[model samples]
Target: MENNFAENISPAFSSIYEEYETLSKENYCDIYRRNTIRKHVETYLNPKDTILEINAGSGIDAVYFAKAGYNVLATDIADSAGIYIKNKIKTEGLKNLEFQKCSFTDLSSIENKKFNHIFSNYGGLNCTNNLEEIFSQFNDLLHPKGFVSLVIMPKFYPWEMATFLKGNKNAFRRWKKNGVLANVNNHLIPTFYHSPKQIKRAMGNDFKAVSIKNIGTFYPSLHYNSLHKHPKTINFLMHLDSWINGKSIIPKGIGDYFIITFQKNT
Candidate 1:
């Protein structure tokens, strides 16, 4: 959480780091991410398990895990977000969480020898085009049979496609390619979208897929701030998402984002 850490990050993400929480502060979509992702993480992790979290934005998920009795090393590329997380950890008097300023591509800075889980939430993994190299490091950082949980933006999503019906064809097919330049915080950065199969192949045979579940399939895009304004309607969609959440691969892979759990076997 050093003030100078911003010098190391790309401009697009630096701008995002500035507006990260402000965009989602009072938004229910943020709550939905917290509830949905936390449930999946808790289901696989036991109390006191150690986790190395990549792109641990503002430490929201890290705090949740600490309160649940897990030790976490929260790593991020942006110092601004890391500083915010550090303050919260201090205010809450949580000793189980530590913040480190580092990108997902480089974990060499981390001193931790091994961890029970290696995690990346939301679309952090999408920011890079080199999954094979990144996943290789993730596997090496874990203990044998340790779990890696990733919440990824799939190559195809209904929400992106929905833009097509609104006459925004370019926006609709942006993710169809393996890589795209996305405008974030008014700066362009390269982003890549990978399908579940592509990710499994990238991870190679050292890991086995445990489970995949749909998230935000029916809950509307997190960008839709008006969801909270219609409590009854949003609640209905939330229930529908819960019912069909893990029922099939079609829904699981086709949602806004999908959770894929893998256990290292080597």
Candidate 2:
């Protein structure tokens, strides 16, 4: 059953990616939500390093990284991603960035190259049914002492738990299940959820955890647009969340996502 489910995963994600590209800037959930992660990248990455971004949705981050002087290679399995990202690169007149169509499972296509840094934002890797395989591939592509940063959806999130307790059982149920089939344009894709410890364990000796920070600790998911109606309130909450997020271990799980940074062993 798992094998069959995994085999059918691409179609569902393809549909989701297609719809995601069509969404207008105002309606795009990733832009505002990814602000925190983008800030982190700005802080850590240097100008000379070569960076590879997996699941480079719409090339937003790619453009940012390229402008910052990093040689950027952005890739995604989505059929529309290449065209969308290329157009973005052209529009921005960014010369340092290149876009490609590739799946996380198959890094062999680009294996001859090594990257100084590798990143995937917004739960892109979590969509895969097998994480260990992906990690193994990542290990191969990274240069010695390279950095790998990923923003992922942990199995437990406070908002989701609270929402579930308030009679929305389906929201809570997604975490309990080890694997879930996300519906995208009438297609089903297998998605795997992991805990922080599980992810660390999977990376094993190849990568060392440098930092693990919480994102959106108080700023709820973008799906809840009702919260955005109050700008002052949302801004206050976001500031408080950012302060507490870096300090507390437990509060990190309260957010919808977490950013985990790992450095490859030299």
Candidate 3:
């Protein structure tokens, strides 16, 4: 069944991925994403800790952590990701960063190893339909009192809803679907959306939420037209977002994504 799904979705996903890779570095959305991940990592991770990053993408965050004195193991299920990350490590001479191809659905291969911090940035965790299974796997991978930080798309995004209301029907419909068939490297990937409450419930009693922040609240999503034409405007929005993002009320559901930090119980 999984193989069939992958085969069906591969072509579309490959094209999507190619486009993503091309725009990732320069896109304002991508820049915000990188900075958000870096901020959370700096807050929770210690210098000597061993960190395991799931869905490491281009391994950019892993390189940052490794450079900061953490031992890093970056994994992604995408075949292209492993080679991309390895080449990056070689080019940068980052000896402390290791690259692997793995999936969140299966951690039996790495279960014996424990990490001081386990992280998945962006919508990596959103790929799974079963949050319980994924959280259980995360629990198994972390040491006692270790941290797990995840960035996921929130179920009710005010900005997205507004975007949709302005006749951006596709944007609105995307969230309404709850689960969508996303293409990744010629593979049709099943993606799930969850509310913050649902995620907390799925983690059960083992993990406790430390903080949750809304990302991209003031700054628009990559698809937003204004961000493309106005550099100064985008920069101004980013600065405003940095100031207002984690406030108790205003920014809660306005962003494109949310970052949630949790700690494994001892």
- TM-score, every prediction: 0.89, 0.88, 0.87
lDDT of 1 at 120: 91
Residues 85-135, candidate 3: write the lDDT tens digits: 798799989888998777776765775578999888878887666788778
Tens digit of lDDT per residue, candidate 1, span 39-102? 8877888779999999887777888888989989999887576777789889999998888888
Q: lDDT, candidate 2, residue 243?
A: 79
Model 2: residues with Cα > 4 Å off, grouped in runs: 1-32, 249-252
- Best first by TM-score, ranked: 1, 2, 3
lDDT of all the models against the reference?
0.77, 0.75, 0.75
Maximum-lDDT candidate: 1
| 1 versus 2: better lDDT goes to | 1
> Whose TM-score is greatest here?
1
Model 2, poorest ten-residue lDDT window? 21-30
Clashing pairs in 3: 9-186, 9-187, 9-188, 10-186, 10-187, 11-186, 13-183, 13-184, 13-185, 14-186
Superposed model 3: Cα runs more than 4 Å off: 1-24, 174-178, 183-187, 251-254
Off by over 4 Å in 1: 1-11, 14-25, 226-228, 249-251
Q: What lDDT would candidate 2 get against the real structure?
A: 0.75
